[model samples]
Target: MSEYYRILGVPENATAEQIKKAYRMLARKYHPDMNPAQDAAENFIRITEAYEILIGERKPPQTKSAPQWSARDIARERAKAYARMRYAEFRRRSDAFDIPMHSLLWPRWVNYFFIVFALFFITDSILPKNTIKCDFRIKHYKYFDACGKVYHLADPHTTVEGQPTGDIVYLRVTPIVGFASSYYIEGDNQNGFLHIQDSPTEYIAAMYVLLVLSVLVLRNKTKKFENKLLIKFGMCIVFVAYLFVYFIWR
Candidate 1:
């Protein structure tokens, strides 16, 4: 039998209003007087019959025997469906880790942070420093903390009266980033004066390099990778490198 739903172009669960609307639209388009096509009259008759049967105005036509399916045919169809499903899943997983070109180096937030830090670095480096006279003492013969700020000296060996000196010195501090850029010590004779200079430029650059490496190693939306052991090893390497650069190498 002809499917009433297919003839009216409406689903089986279509509401009465929906079926009526579909019948009206199709009838108007396929009416013999409106459409001069030869099949228009036949289509209009079919839609009219479908509308009557669906609205209980007439009895439905008798249906034919149902098509039979063998076990082998069903299994073959299932296997084909399974293969298609697996292929779709494989595509999704394969492209999960594909990083975009813009975010290849760093994420959006990280990029913004780098820009702010660079601006601060440049502004602090250019602006005139606020020099404060404070008593500087050598700690482990490498660095000293003065006025609640740490300073790494370029040359720790300063002679006072022809000996290793530890005395009050000028602490040059920048306003923006509050970095202690350089320092100088007073001398009795004009020729005996010492002005040692050091900056955190190298240390800051090293820190940024390490941060970039870290982002490359760990950045991913899926939080997964094929090389589990290699990823952990790379993270360890980054950690060790950061420590060495910040403490010993900086």
Candidate 2:
């Protein structure tokens, strides 16, 4: 009957496969276990009844106990039910492949990298530049050594004044020179320096926090070992390239 077909959301000429598919899809959506809507149980009963009748598994109920319903009212109800089913199907498909905002730019790991890098630059710009005054002796024409720490003169003849104090001379120290080594120390000397500039400890700590958060999020969200490996590889490349450009290139 037209009413049975409408209840199951299938065409009257639909094949057995189409009828079964439609029934299953609608059943899953309206099933009491899956949907908690106020009328879900009633809709589920109708779906089952329609399915049984269409498949010749059961006969339609007698009209003696059935409530009288006008054709216009039935048509309106069918239209509403079909609209709800269509909306549910669209929502299910959307949820199955939900895309994250960060994924628009790159993978999660790359997004983490860019976010942390951007924060570093932003904080660096906000914080006042700091410098440390230290004693250095001219090691070469452009190179200088302060205590055991060695650095190339940023302005050579212009920044340093007068003569060296014996073999040692006083000069301003700014660690992690150049654009890429923002979080690392620059000079060859590991010790001996005066406080003149901002300490990189906070910036480095922020980066570490970002790294740990990214790792935790990735561990929870991704199950594939290859994906984890790719993320690690990308991080390694970022570090290696940073070091190579700023530390080795100089």
**What's each prediction's clash count?**
0, 9
Distance (Å) between predicted and true CA of 250, model 2? 18
lDDT of 1 at 35: 88
C-alpha local distance difference test of each model: 0.58, 0.55
Worst 10 residues of 2 by lDDT: 176-185
Task: Tell me the tens digit of each residue's lDDT in model 2 across 1-250.
Answer: 7899998888899898999999999988987668999898678767866887789876654454544544444445556555665677689767644544334324666756655764564465356544443455667655555546554544323244622234434443233342222211235332343332222322345445445545554444654545555555555565555444334424
Q: Please list the Cα RMSD from the true structure of every candidate, rounded to 1 decimal place.
A: 16.0, 12.2
Residue pair clashes in candidate 1: none
Q: On a 0 to 1 TM-score scale, where does candidate 1 land against the true structure?
A: 0.43
Candidate 2 is scored at a TM of: 0.31
lDDT at position 88, candidate 1 = 62
Give the number of the best model, judged by TM-score: 1
